[model samples]
Target chain A: MSETNELKVREKQEVAPSAELTKPGPVFTPHVDIFETDNSLTLLVDMPGVKADDLNVDLRDDILTLTGDAKPSLATPGEKIYGEYETGRYYRQFSLSEVIAQDKIDAKLSDGVLRLTLPKVEKATPRRIMVQVD
Target chain B: MIYRTLFGAPGRRFGASLKELEEMQQRMDRLFNGFRDRSAGRVGVGAGVFPAINISEDTGAYYVSAELPGVTSADLEINVTANQLTLAGERKISKEAADARYHRREREAGRFSRALALPGDIDADNVKAGLADGVLTITIPKAEKAKPRQITVQ
Candidate 1:
């Protein structure tokens, strides 16, 4: 096994209890990766076992909240011998900056990963103005 | 924390006293394991956590599920031996532009391999595996000799 390429297993981070729970189970904060380009900011969120219809993405007053309900996959419950992780809903929030065009944001979910693209406003995009010499 | 065998067996749900004991045992296990995890200096860092798994069994088969967000069927490889099941896969995150600046990066991309010792002999020919929503579920049927048989009382 290559030491550098080995996958490091991290336990899921549970959402803080300070957040009010709308549902009855443990909620976890999904891991996320955010990057910004010249035109837009992209967020990749990992929420395994969540279906597209069960996910809710809400944005208001520069606060973006993501909630996904992940149902148990087993149709028939069996004797659980060993479990490393528990099934729960995923919840997280991020406050956006003024430069982001909230209305123009786009979201897509595929294979348990949610990708959000927030386009920058025209004023915030970098533009090079050519100097004219008469 | 390392995984532990859950207390209480099938059909024990009606035993309230046993159920309470199970819950108490679970709480105590967590309390002590939390200390062990911290002392090992692996708390929060998750030194060996990857593709978290859950193993369970019914009368006829054993089931194993792994959480592998963002991984597709094309990147996974599954192999089962007489007493072991091996999962090997690679996760790839699309590359962004050269000028892209990362605000936070927690998702990872790489190859990972894990081999588990199955509890009983597996009917390798009939094992079923499927990947959906980035989670992989493997259904391993127990071998004929390993499966429980109901013997009539003579």
Candidate 2:
């Protein structure tokens, strides 16, 4: 019951609070997934409807920014469509911690998917030691 | 007589042959134009369409690669079912102020999904995925029977 109440509250908050209220401005938001492996941390971002030449990735002052644009589909006059997916530019930002290796980060974009590989610093990775017995 | 046999009647033969010849010419023109368009770099999903991918058996593991240019690792979802592999996610637009006007927008956006049928059955529990430089590389180790083995001779 409490959970349902909370969800209802959330839904209410998302709805417009009043009539004549201005619509919110467009936001630059991108969905991202992070995974960690033995060697590196990988990030995959989807930037569909975007071309390679229009993407930009940068890391500045511990903040990583990814920005790109997506082209809209061509619409003919008097054409009737029944979908509500909008294509536009994409923007996302991430604040990095000291644990991340800033200098060795690698990024690539292909087929509308962006991938980032961040290798851990030497001191951050686990080291195995061999023990010998006499 | 020949016209009657060719078109099922005498008067309609010329018209039918003319229409047939026009269609054949149109088809030939389309074929040539398609070749020319491809040579001009207009093939396979145009400028913003993502690349279609296929994974083949490589050594001891399954290799997966997808063409996702201008995308980073932060925007991907990969899942493996019993015998199917699914890649689904969205790419957002670049963030700018509300008043910014785009002159030439040509990137793909919104959600995209790709599913692959594995060549051989795999252990979904052990599947692994990696993304580097806009390419997603998934490595699925072959099952016990699927892996190559050497028999002993007595």
Candidate 3:
């Protein structure tokens, strides 16, 4: 009876390990500040080490992908006595809802910051109705 | 009696002399000029502090490009370790003036660093870097195992 219980426990652990492996890896969420205006939604993403030429923003179907690379700051080989930040490639993805107008989306990168302007679809925006008096 | 009443003492006479006053004025003028010279070059671009880089991937390799306008080839450094790539440089602006009045100066001058971690593992040894038209380009070839391969069906 004890042998059967041990086998069941082992099988359960193995199944959990596989399940975890199939899950998505950790997402490197960029620091983003979103603002909604009358005509569009402005998204500002802080890509500190990124350069304007290196940034790529793509929208396909409902998914938006942001990819870029950042170069290191030191030229000659020296002892890195103190360092906190890890400079590397940046990747982020976001799923947009139907309210977004894909065709009107515009993006710009300046000074390592990426700004995306997402316009809402006409029908998605709120409309004002006129009232007439008889 | 008149010299004693007017000059008082030798030290006082020296301090109140025209030559001494001229020397003190020159020292004060030098201090003020130094302050003006330092403050004249203070131009700050608050939101403009990041380098620009471009990256693209093909079937076999990944390409990255960056705009380093004032950076010289000797000032730039590129390194690739495992799947990470970094580009770092220092931008120094040295201005000499014989008799030039400043109208307006707006340029970033300081040390700048940028780094990017690649998505997939790359062959570090095969990476190549080049600079053209103030833009630096780096090509990182994908590893054999990391490259996409077509499998044949038996």
Better of 1 and 2 by lDDT: 1
* Predicted candidate 1 versus true structure: per-residue lDDT over A70-130, tens digit per residue: 8875322478777677778898989988477778989999888999998988774587999
Of candidate 3 chain B, the 10-residue stretch with the lowest lDDT total is: B40-49
lDDT of 3 at B143: 86
lDDT of 2: 0.57
Q: Rate the local accuracy (lDDT) of all candidates.
A: 0.82, 0.57, 0.59
TM-score of 2: 0.38
**Interface RMSD in Å per candidate, to 1 decimal?**
4.0, 16.8, 24.2
What TM-score, over all chains together, does every model reach? 0.78, 0.38, 0.37
Clashes of each: 5, 50, 23
Of the candidates shown, which would achieve the greatest lDDT relative to the real structure?
Answer: 1
Q: What tens digits encode model 3's per-residue C-alpha lDDT throughout A42-77? A: 666655456767778888887878866565541112
Model 3 agreement with the true structure over B29-113: per-residue lDDT tens digits? 9998768744542212212324544466776778776555445678777888999987777754434233433222333356666
Give model 2's docking category.
incorrect
lDDT of 1 by residue, B1-154 (tens): 1232254453565586788999999999999998896463233433255677888899899988888998899889999999799999888888778998999988888888888889899899998988877778999999999999999999
lDDT of 3 at A46: 53
Worst 10 residues of 2 chain B by lDDT: B41-50
